[model samples]
Target: MPVQFIKDPNQVGDAINESNTKPVVIHYWNPLMGEESPFLSLFHDADENLGPNVSLYVVDSGFINPPHDPQELPLTALYVDGKEKQSVPFNVDQVRDLIFSAV
Candidate 1:
């Protein structure tokens, strides 16, 4: 399925809770500096690896400027099932492996 765009923490929480049988990967990135951010590359790379058993959620926090460095915008990978499976610092190849492993 296509990635779902969630706007807040509550929406993320809801998605996590609602997704029971499949793995949910939340992609949080800044949309304001979207084309300029390294996350754009990472996001595309991750999307290419996504499969049917996985659900990808894209969330734009809208906190893209000062006080919130683009780097701080949760570039990590979260595997939310009954509880959070695991969270790690974002790495394109590593994340790709994780997604493939999940499926």
Candidate 2:
């Protein structure tokens, strides 16, 4: 499925609710990191490769705080049935594995 952009921090719960129907991959990005952030590109690539089994959501960390209070700038989290399963620091291979593992 296409990547869903979480425009507001308040919508985090909405994303979690959506996870009940399908696994959700939430990739947190700090806007201050700039538009050329590699993690952003990673997420786009993941969205293309992940197909329809999983839902990918992008959250702008510069404007909001993610669950678990992750210390990393770009955090990739896996949520299943409205509960978070794992959160990892941004990495091309790791993000790919995280998303695939959820399915």
Candidate 3:
């Protein structure tokens, strides 16, 4: 599963809407994430395991639209059926759990 890098909110919305076929796990991050970039590797680790049941979108900060705050550097949003299901802060186990659960 390739992690998508969305630019603006419109792209993000499109990605989330397309997720109607499968759950979407989008991570909104910025350069400030620094060492935390390695933390996101967990998603890649989970990628191949999830197969086609999930879609991963890793968007940069300032591209967050409604329901997501721009000030939040690293926010994770879970979308199902083209709707925002859950949003949370960056966390390793938590995000991995969210993806597995969606699967």
Candidate 4:
């Protein structure tokens, strides 16, 4: 499926728990980073080759209190079977590997 945007901060949990059989990728980004952030490109690159069975989501980190430090402007998490497996700073290769390896 295509990458989905998390509109409500309250619904972040729901987005992560939405699928059970496939890997779920949640990208948390600060809007303050603007469109020029290198992290934004990493998110976009992963989205382009995302598998159909993978559930992808984008969250505006500013809208939600993320577990990691806000200074970590962009974070990407991988969830397997409705539970978080790993979270890391935005990196194109790492993100891509996280998704495909899980599949």
For each candidate, what is the lDDT? 0.59, 0.77, 0.76, 0.69
TM-score for all models, in order of appearance: 0.64, 0.83, 0.85, 0.75
Task: Give the per-residue lDDT digits (tens) of candidate 2, residues 44-70.
Answer: 777788788888888875543444564
Question: Which stretches of model 4 miss by more than 4 angstroms?
Answer: 36-50, 61-66
Distance from true position, residue 41, model 4, in Å? 6.0
Of the candidates numbered 1 and 3, which has the greater TM-score value? 3
Q: lDDT at 8 for candidate 4?
A: 81
**Candidates ranked by lDDT:** 2, 3, 4, 1
Candidate 4 lDDT by residue in tens digits, 18-70: 65767787777777877433555545655677657677778874653356667
Model 3 alpha-carbon drift over 4 Å, by segment:
none
Provide the lowest-lDDT 10-residue window in model 1. 62-71
Give the poorly placed runs of model 2, Cα more than 4 Å off.
61-67
Report the Cα lDDT for residue 27, model 1.
59
In candidate 1, list every pair of residues with a backbone clash: none
Candidate 1 per-residue lDDT over residues 26-82, each given as its tens digit: 656666745343555545555666655677776677432222356766554445454
Q: What's the CA RMSD for each of the models?
A: 4.8, 2.1, 1.9, 2.7
Question: Which is better, 1 or 4, measured by TM-score?
Answer: 4
Residue-by-residue lDDT tens digits, candidate 3, 1-103: 6877776767887888877888998887775656345546777877878877799888764467576567775777789999988877767777777777777
